[model samples]
Target: MVRTAAAVWCSASAVVLAFAAIHLNPTRSEPAAASANGNHAAVKTLQHRASQPHDADQQLNDVYRSHTCGAVAKANAESAVGQPGSIPCIGDQVKVAGWLEFKRLVGDNVFLSIRDIHGSVQVVFRQEDFVGFTEVRALIDKLPKQSVVSISGIVTARPQTAVTEASAVEIAASSLVVLNRATLVPFDHQQTNVSEELRQQHRYYDLRNPKLQHSLQVRSKVTQVIRSVLADEGFLEVETPTLFKRTPEGAREFLVPTRTPGQFFALPQSPQQYKQMLMVAGVDKYFQFARCYRDEDLRADRQPEFTQLDMEMSFIRPIDIQNVIEKIVARAWLEVHGMKLELPFRRMPYQEAMEQYGIDKPDTRFGMKLQNLQACKELLSQASVARGFRVQVPESLRSPFKKALPRLIKELALRNAVTKPFNGLPAALEDATLAQLDLVGADFVCIATGDHAESVLQRLGKLRLAVAAELERLGHPLRNPNEFHFLWVEDFPLFTESDTAQAADGTMALEATHHPFTAPHPNDAHLVFTDPRKVRGLHYDIVVNGWELGGGSIRIHDSDMQERLIREVLGADITKFSHLLKALRTGAPPHGGIALGFDRMMAILLSARSLREVIAFPKAFSGRDLTCEAPSAISDKDLADYGLKLIAQPDTKL
Candidate 1:
């Protein structure tokens, strides 16, 4: 009689046994039937089994088993495992399985590179080892690149020089079994014929490339760092509904038809309203790695769907929130790139920034300041008079110059032609006059290097000759990219006058430059009625290298101000925001938050040309995922299952 049981082991030689033996005590009862037959039969069987002592051990050896590897598992194992231990020595005989990433045929011996969950190892096989098996060589040749294979061999430390020179160490090989074959071409050998469309269609393959893999890894690290930092700061990671009620903010939403007829849900453009509502619910610190969707034009920095680290905190001033974020961003930079940013970054008023830089988000890295020419009218007037009596004046220029003088003077608001003393003109008038003349004579005085001083001045002699020949072709001088001008625009107007659309009540309305919820500055609230353009909100944006990294504003938590902001300023229907109004009435706390473009941050950090390079599966310029073939038409069955219907597209006569 043989007792059979199962055993497990990491390697073939190490047998593991189960502890299932039962203990018998004097107090325990025994079955009457067992008592009659067990004593005589057990005694005889025990005596018989003693004659064959190796039976139990042989059965245990047979029970131990190994697993076969697959392609994806092999890839996962390679990444999961660490480098082999130092000091070459043979370990226990083990059976390992994974994909053979590489192999080299050396005369009659083959060097095989195999990776398993434990790690990768190099295996050597001699021709004589498989002397009776011709099929082994044929199978080896037929093995697909990246195909899964199992090898049972004695583990041994690699030779000293071999370990140092080789990409991988450790050699083992006894038996090999192919598990799964990879169908696609190896990533390195993929053809040039591969199209962007095909790459997107087969995104799994596209992501296999080392460059994309590393980029996605970095992106993951960035998000992890953000989550860790925010969590440490007492931020609650709350998830908001992706399907939301449609409310017009700015960008259009992708509507989802509902099972209930005539009703629909809109995909969230952002978790803006919900996060604010969280503040109302007494969840003071809330943050989410939000997925935002929008139906709008796409650019390098813009995506149909993108991610942002959205955060909001209650009972805090605008500056408090800004400081928290500044610390987080600085820490992120230091942790990720080992660079410490200057504390308390400079803040600029919106109005002043616009006036000087002609746009917000001034790149403070370089300088070519836009000089106000109106302040220097005295210089312009003097130069004009001196030019008129210059020794060399072309006859053709004299008449046209005189004709243009009146137009320039009128545009500059000159009091008189010659009688208006330059010094007596107002500062604004002087600056305007100088800026106008400078526009007409916009040639740079290029002093050629190594030229004689007299000869360099001679180059100026050709100015009139060149201007006469190509006056129509040369208009204004080109902007120089080398000169970087940095500035902070402050005091941005809260509203802008526009005529794009009528208000909800069929009346003219003022557009909130930021948003309806942004709070007006305490001192500027009264100016909203008297002069809307002069009123500024408690809003701020951080711009660097001419890119808007993030923006936020103090929110209107007071019910009265919130209602007035929507009704009077934005001209939005009061009923449309009833839920928000209700929340505001429930003792909402003062709060503000900012959402930074993660992709754009990476772009600036890496100095990449486009944000797409930092994204793993970025949509094309037209907002189509070429790799996944997304935005493809859905099957009628799927639509029916979801209780949806497709709207007919308008016909075009192209």
Candidate 2:
């Protein structure tokens, strides 16, 4: 049909006759006649006007002088013609303007389409309809795709052949004008495998592509929904300072130096401190569109700076925080995807999650659930703790690991070993402990044991993901992207032995698994000082499709206990936390909060490959902003004033 339109637009008089149809019958009570070939009789008159191109030119000039090419938007067109798969603004004449998305020429007519922020519409230009406006046709012919233009025309019900994204109705232009012109793009934005560097360099052009536009739009709407839902739940939206004191909140913070030589303020890793302070201030609830920063190793999913929907509440239980976040999450899914999730998402304790899936954040959509054979074998053992037998899965699946397992396990043991054990396993269960269980469809099962059980288990978890990916590539998709599976991984250990931290005797000392402030379980409070390893924090993490969506924990309110935690378990400076300690000592209520990775949520909502796709202007893998060429060296004088210096290294270094 586009080809036919191209052929029909060959003649130049199609616009001349279209003008007469509108002017001569501005409000004709009867419709124009259609011939046996489906061509309007007016089109026949257009052919007759072909002999007088000069007269056609003059008529178009008059129409151009008389009509206003003001503005009619894609949104206006959508509103006027709101039916699905079709626009129906027949007989309504208006001026529309937007970037020319497409163009085609036929016998004596032209078909053009334009796109604006809201949507796109098709414009039909009959040469006869323009009368003497030959310049209008000339303007279109000379312009490139994406040229901004305006058209004054009557909305006519399109013929059956004309149905498309523009719908059942189209504007038959009597006059046209170009507002701006765009140069041809060097490459197709539709190409999926475009180079990342090139796309980042030309992010503006990249965003103009429909895919990026759609993603940002949905992101905006979902954010609004989040705000609305939270507001309805009594969360007071608040803004906190970007420049804060250097307090330990994990991840490296970017420091901002002041004019006072050595003074510095650190950027927040999250609103963790401020939100907790809000709770101390007696604020019942608080939330913020928080901007967080971190100078960590970069990946496709990690950014130096990102956005999070951070919220906190006072006098709330772990379940209360979970319920609050669940509603917002469910609301987001409903508003963005129009699907209501089942209420009360599933729950799994941190240990169970680790035992079953090998990771705290488990993608529950599909399963290659892990089995703890050692735990099962303990009851069967008559002697001490069963140790040491390595069972590689079935022989078929075990062939690849000529020596891979031992090497990786050794590496994990060095970096993540909780305790160096006696390696004592009863001879009988030695083989079973290390034995890999051969499962139904899978070629083999993976099992690991050591002081670094969590570490080894995490490695096994990654291997599980890789295997699942391979199976999907081979035609069995275990984890479907379209399905969302959410569960709360609760009852996290209050303390874990940090690989680098050490006790007085030099053995690995206990450190806050989540943070120093997390309160221990009521029953486990006595173990905080005696056996930190056994204490469970009242914490929970919300996992969705295998991603750690968000996490929160009940906070410690007792100053003495907080001091004991800081000075003993974590072995940190109590003076540094004097402010938080004083606040806790004050009359404060039990409080808890959570911060959702808003950027990741956006990526999940749109199935974006990475968080960068959802961010407006993300930095490159090198942590440099390509668009503005950021992170450049500062002036020598400015550095000197800030009490900073640049070391002159050998020319061999970057």
Candidate 3:
């Protein structure tokens, strides 16, 4: 199921009350105001004037009032009722009254979905069912969604679990009443123009699809399960500001200009601050299924707006928070997929992870471990052949092997440049370097006719053997498909070199790897000023199947450290976050939190190629919705409503 971040504006209490009312009176009277609404008026008129009531409404109401709408009533009605047009049937001979949603008309029979009061109900009719009603055939051909009609037929239950099965059934029409006609554009007619995106824009019709209906239903259940699980764990489900003052986070904020003029409120990137503030307000635990917005590039796994299970707790250690999350996740898995997840999942340090897998979130399901070439360079050079093959060297220098050594070293350095500075090559590389290796012969060669051809060929063969051996070694068990590897990357560096290393104030500054709020290790406090690279924070990430599922850290609860960290590491003045600092001064408890990607989780659960498969209405890869035509040109009046103006491209003369 696609997990969508949709807010259920209706209160749960209202749903419960509505269900209760329906249960209390199965044959409840229609509202007085609805008496003149054509269809209801027809039913009411029949009920009031009939000397002896002969409609299905009167008969069904009688059955419901006497025995109620449950298994017992259904059983009694089935035993007492006869086949269509047969005598000794106590209930009135009624026709199925609904719109034909879907249809298949054979030579003399039809199978169609009828849009009844309760939703779509399937009805199957044979030629005999409407033998005397020629007009019904014409009506059936033109029947569309939301059309209202009454067909008098013998009611019976279906024999199997086919499309036409329900507690009640109808057959053999004595008459056809066209109560209301529908203006529906048939599905076939919209084939060229109706994309899924467009269908979402026209969600009313899209909801009629069983697949979408099931997906949305499952989504609702997931939300309910999340709410129930959190509430049970004594977590206070709180609402936070959707708009607030923007701060420098990882992503660009979606800004909403204010009526007050000049000032603006940024749609939340995540409820990070507000949830933490709950802890300051003495609320021990806080959580919200928050809608987060980011004005950034979109991808299959990302949206312009998304949701996160934002959570925070007071006076809790890192392990405490992890345990809470474990329980919540385990419960969610059981509820959603009916699977029990293992608790206390394995944790691997960030440094260890990069050294082994070259990725923070190592997909535990496979093994293709990265090896460090630098560690075993000397040993590899000593080997006449590396990995059982002769090493290849360019012929352009005095000593071909000696000259290429520098190039090889440069290549190794280039590979290391992309990863964290501290990470090194793996132990396997060292073992391979120590072993004598040879390269296999290449398919083609460049010959120097003036030189001794035999000697040149022999040397070239040696180089080919070495190259083949090295390439073969590089291709090993790391590429195996059967293994699943889950990893925990922790103790990430507190700061990293910024794009512009030199500060405007001529003071040294660095960019925070995670965020300024992350608390550095106590032992590394001094290094925060002297050598920022050496400072490690209490940060951790959960990586599974090669995807970073979530990340979090123990937050800086101490006000002084928070300000200093921001100024020293993030290169930002304290004034920008002064309000947050002030909140911390009010005796904020030690807190930490993580945000789980709900859409990504669903994508994993469904084994979907993209998050779009799980989503009911997702934009295209370019973030365009062909169905609804969203993010299109807005009207000038609409732009004026929000106090905004559009700036045309500089070169566009128009």
Candidate 4:
């Protein structure tokens, strides 16, 4: 049942204990050779003397001996694990039963420790105390680790025992029952070098690891907090389609073959189209913990399926959209981190962020802000004159980035910092900055110049990150994980030349930078038709610590504007969007919303190295479910029924 990228909802207890991940390794466990079905029996020898030691608190430990055991001690163990409320239930007889985890024994006295999901309590056994049950006495000595045992005992106060995280009281058991027995533990999961492959294969055992349990608990809590805040703010939770039509030009899709031959349903890339229609249908506010799927090659930040906090609001302006999202974000911070994020997070234009940090999602924790070489006539002359490369500028300046990217990438490879699949950024970068920017080393200063401003900034952005990594190793704390630098990058261009699009004569054509529905900035209205490059849209992306956490835009509500932009500017066909086009014609209200990468945020909150750490059963970067060996070939009969042909046979070799 290990489905790749399956959505898991969180619970309240999980949320509270999510961050409580520190492991309480048992002070004592059975020796490795000790097994339930054992033949070669070896036990650590214990000192036979069991007299009143000078340590009075240690002398009173019920686990060591039954100093007090009687019929009076037989109530619920949970109420006695810790003192009930403010009052001590020290003398209360408790009937607590849970799996036995740890034990210690002296020659004449034995100790048994048990724990339930709720709490842990100690049980004491002495040979003299169990007079009537010789068989039970032998069983107690033979019981394996993780044996399910229930014991009735009197809770005795131990004022002399060392006060630690565990309860200050012990239970002197008058009765015991071994409900079930467990075999020897499978492997040493605590090993630092334990492979992820092993963990995924033995995932059930992996979850038993306290650290992973805590992470999952935290994930549960974060989502619950977000859901609560959204509900209080009047956002209606709604369900959207998982199986829908293909958005062929968007992120790659996972197609589900249908009953009809050659027909298939695509898993949604986002709840984008449906959520917009909801706005048109007068659902003023809509949200979902949406399950989204995309079939692109995988990375640490991506899964073939993932969760997004899908939201849309009607009759809202650009700031209105930003305000609500900021509120949710701030509330999450306050609840989890106990700090108020600076009200109305700091905003920068797309151009400003790109120029300053070399990336739209800038990690502002460190100061390696890119300095424009051209800012100084001397620096510009020095940069271009020494170790220079050339870019062939194109006449159209359309998709010019494609032409400019190669040489700069080659330069990065020269430095041994760049490689294919390069953008899989770490979940957290602690204090990594462009220390190299300040270093006076005997090497060429990296400079990017190109026809398209975006192309130049994009290349520089990659180099900025590369340098940041190098700086961290060089001892610079530029991208500090401890810092929360939430940024709003705004005024993104409304259109860019689509890589997949072509003009009538086979030239690249323009498409919405974000989406066709995004509204052009009111100030850029004049430039929409005149110069697409300068026409900034009311689109924004929210980032933290260099990760693009969420993105949204003020959607185009005006029918005439939508039509003109689609037909005259972008040259996209209008007939296919008839439903949305009709809704706009019928007077759609201005709407906008943002979708937060929920899983990515969890990774950040939990300090995980990858999204898979937060996800329950995430597929590997190869897009295969390692636990179940999925992405396996479909049955030949089913393929034939679906009228599909094999392009190439799947390799049947190891």
lDDT for each candidate structure: 0.57, 0.69, 0.55, 0.64
Candidate 4 lDDT, 148-235, residue by residue in tens: 6556555675446533345567776554544456665555544788887777766665665556767777778878888898888898
Evaluated against the true structure, the overall lDDT of model 2 is 0.69
Q: How many backbone clashes does candidate 4 have?
A: 13
* Per-residue accuracy of model 2 over 354-400 as CA lDDT, tens digit each: 87677899998976777655554453433332222222234543434
In order of appearance, the predictions have TM-scores of: 0.64, 0.78, 0.66, 0.73
- Model 1 regions more than 4 Å off: 1-138, 148-177, 186-194, 355-357, 375-491, 502-509, 605-610, 613-617, 634-654
The runs of at least 3 residues in candidate 2 whose Cα sits more than 4 Å from the true structure, single-residue gaps closed, are: 1-88, 131-138, 183-186, 375-443, 449-451, 648-654
lDDT of 3 by residue, 482-565 (tens): 223445678888886665677676855478887788888877978887778799988887776677767788899999988887
Candidate 3 residue spans exceeding 4 A from truth: 1-101, 114-121, 145-204, 375-487, 500-509, 613-620, 623-654
* TM-score computed on alpha carbons, candidate 2: 0.78
Candidate 3: deviation at residue 380, Å?
Answer: 9.5
Q: Which ten residues in a row have the lowest lDDT in candidate 2?
A: 1-10
The local lDDT score (0 to 100) that residue 8 gets in candidate 4 is 15
Best by TM-score: 2
Model 3 clash number? 40
The local lDDT score (0 to 100) that residue 59 gets in candidate 1 is: 35
Count of residue pairs whose backbone atoms collide, per candidate: 23, 52, 40, 13
